[model samples]
Target chain A: MSKAVIPGMIARKTGHIINIGSTAGKEVYPKGNVYCASKYAVDALTKGMRIDLLPHGIKVTQIAPGMAETEFRSVRFGGDGPVRHRFTKVWTRCGRRTSPNWCTM
Target chain B: MRGRRAQAVEVRGLIDGLMVVRLAERGRQVKPEDQQQQRKGTHDPQMCWLACELTASGEQEVAWSTGPHAKVAFLCPMPKLILITGATSGFGEATARRFAAEGHRVIITGRRKERLEALRSELEGMHGKVEARRSFILFTSTCATMPLCKRSFPPTGMERDRCAGEQCGPRRRAGPDPGRPSRGLGAHAGHQLKACCT
Candidate 1:
């Protein structure tokens, strides 16, 4: 994003840059180590860019959504049906707690 | 049954009120005194801006739905050109696919060449292929390929010192014109909402 899109936005003297983030950027939970790190990086980068690009009149926004029902679950579990079902069934009850059972992909 | 009946009456009243106001205003001719202001085009752009600000709150609720102001939103148009990174899988792939489905130009980038190629094919079925080989290896144990961009584009040594935005003026403007009067939600419309430009 920095190397390509941002440069273009700066040159244009006007542009909107939306960085789609996740709640993982704010709160860290089990099984979200790498994801959280990346999201945090995005959040920080977004903040820095927003400040730096103000003079250039470039707009930067970060939209962070929570727990979307998408292929993310399928990809994360590698198509493990029972585990996926267990997580689906117990996610509400057990998601906040970082137990080994809930932690594994 | 009683609740449904009440709702019908309320809706009827609302619609009637709206039309009555419209009809009453249409019937009244402007005062001779007010015609001077009209001839002079004395409406303040600032007031136009103030009115926009007052209506901004309610506009959010109707942004995604079929509202009259959904397109252009009485301000500048929303952004159309987008660059989606990490497009090999997951959200990136879905977002890029959506832009293509809507007949908008999209540029999807990722480290995975095969995945990028697959996405390009999916987005462009048998037409419009523009390929440029610029390898930027983001995270690696070694910095062996760090200077690859020096040759075809800007020299690597000087480019690193300056910000990418400072260096790429014409390229950026030539890329997209999303800040114009766009559809859906207006991007770059208000000063406070400058961040929503994307």
Candidate 2:
């Protein structure tokens, strides 16, 4: 994709590439090892692309969304619908959405 | 101390190996069911295949679950040629839905064909081609069956030209150039949008 677009973007001397990053890129957790590492790589590449593509006058921005409702949880967990539903219920019930449901911590 | 305890797995070798196998089997048999199940985040094979394509294409997704405020700001100048990744579900889908409803010229992409198709039909049915509607919904995996220059809905085809309002000449998609993964699209097409959006 970069091979194809960089030429055009460089030639045009006008374009923007916004790469989606994650908080995982900057922080680390137990089960988030791979995701964190991958996001870190994204951050690295965003920096690299910013530097390299700067001459061509292309804007490179990385958006590291903290978190929200998305299929990410589904993808991370797998396609098990019931498990996902129950898990989300538990998650939302806990303060990610509502509070006083389960303050175990 | 807390930061030092992270144990990141080194699965680059395994992932790279699998990607190679997928690349080798590019033009082989694919199950339509796999195509359909892609939207729901189901089917391991489908997800892996789409992930491989994205990884191969080297396009970073730009989705966020924050809100329409930030994105709406980005898509300013009003109607945008938005190129969303993972539009099959979640924020991607919601963004696509909002944009389509507002009648923007979008170029929505995702790993799921069925979901993409479904979105197209719903949008068309509700608000059919209201001027700024050359919206292209690209199912991430390269589809050979889909033509190069036409307004495809479910089995959507991508033309380099949008706004299907203008003469097809101005917007005609370029050739299946070198280093492009599939058709006139499936490769640098994402960057093409980046340039076009600029």
Candidate 3:
């Protein structure tokens, strides 16, 4: 996405790029190691893309949302299974503690 | 401690949303109207729909039991308008319910028309006044992707790249062209509204 937009950035000479990274990029969870690594890559990409495109007057940014209420829970917890139930309990109990002010979706 | 924690939570939430919008804006996937709608809190159909899903999926049962502390923890100030994608279920649905209850205009989108209709009816019944201008629902598979397609304006077959690092992340296929005009490159560049509100 960043690459495709580079042209637009160059053409505009003043563009903004916002990367939707994740908290996983900043810190790894026990079960979410790979996901975290990908996010880290995103973090790196944001910096690299920003610096590379800075000459064109483009601004780069990254957003790393954590524990947002979305389909992520269902996907992670195992869709209508016991894992779902247990994870839901843990999520409801611990989500606010870990993520603080989280939003849905 | 509790009050401080709540304040921290609120800040984080705002930051997260802002971050996403900033990222989207930087990426150029967002349109000016979309940004304006987002600022009004009526953009990002996925989030609104997720809220509705959470509400309908028996989560409302937990809302009361979660207690005042939890309420404070989860309480989000209503935006003037909200756009949600993937709103058929889960977080999107729950968000829609919450926003409507709080008297915000909401636009929802998803692949499922039935669910969207149901949600519209449900929200109207609950709010007593259907927010026609604020409430909208669309059927699109790539609804979350850039440049929302309204009923009157169909997509122009231009697929904006995915966010920076998704599975099929945007590939830099187009090389830098020195000859391209430097001004007015963005389709919606001059529009007063910026893209994707936080």
lDDT of every model, 2 decimals: 0.42, 0.47, 0.45
Model 1 clash pairs are: A16-B197, A16-B198, B77-B180, B77-B181, B77-B182, B78-B182
Candidate 2 backbone overlaps, count: 2
- Clashing residue pairs found in predicted model 2: B160-B173, B161-B171
Residues B1-198 of candidate 1: C-alpha lDDT, one tens digit per residue:
322111110010111001000111221222323322222223344433332342332221011101222221221123244456666666666666544433334556666777777767644441122111111122211122222222112211122222222341222222246333221112332232344344
- List model 3 lDDT by residue over A1-105, tens digit each: 233334444543555665667888998889777888899999999987776666667788887766544566557766678876665577778645332223442
Maximum-TM-score candidate: 2
Residue B82, model 1, lDDT:
49
The top-ranked prediction according to lDDT is 2
Question: Residue by residue across B1-198, what tens digits does model 3's lDDT show?
Answer: 322111110111132232111111111222233323434333344443343333333222111111223221122332243456667775567666665544455657677788888877766554332233344544555634233322111111222332211212222333233343222223443231122211
The native-contact fraction of candidate 1 is 0.03
DockQ numbers for every candidate? 0.13, 0.05, 0.07
In terms of TM-score, how similar is model 1 to the real structure? 0.44
What is candidate 2's DockQ? 0.05
TM-scores of chain A in all candidate models: 0.67, 0.71, 0.71
lDDT of model 2 at position B73: 11
Model 2 docking grade: incorrect
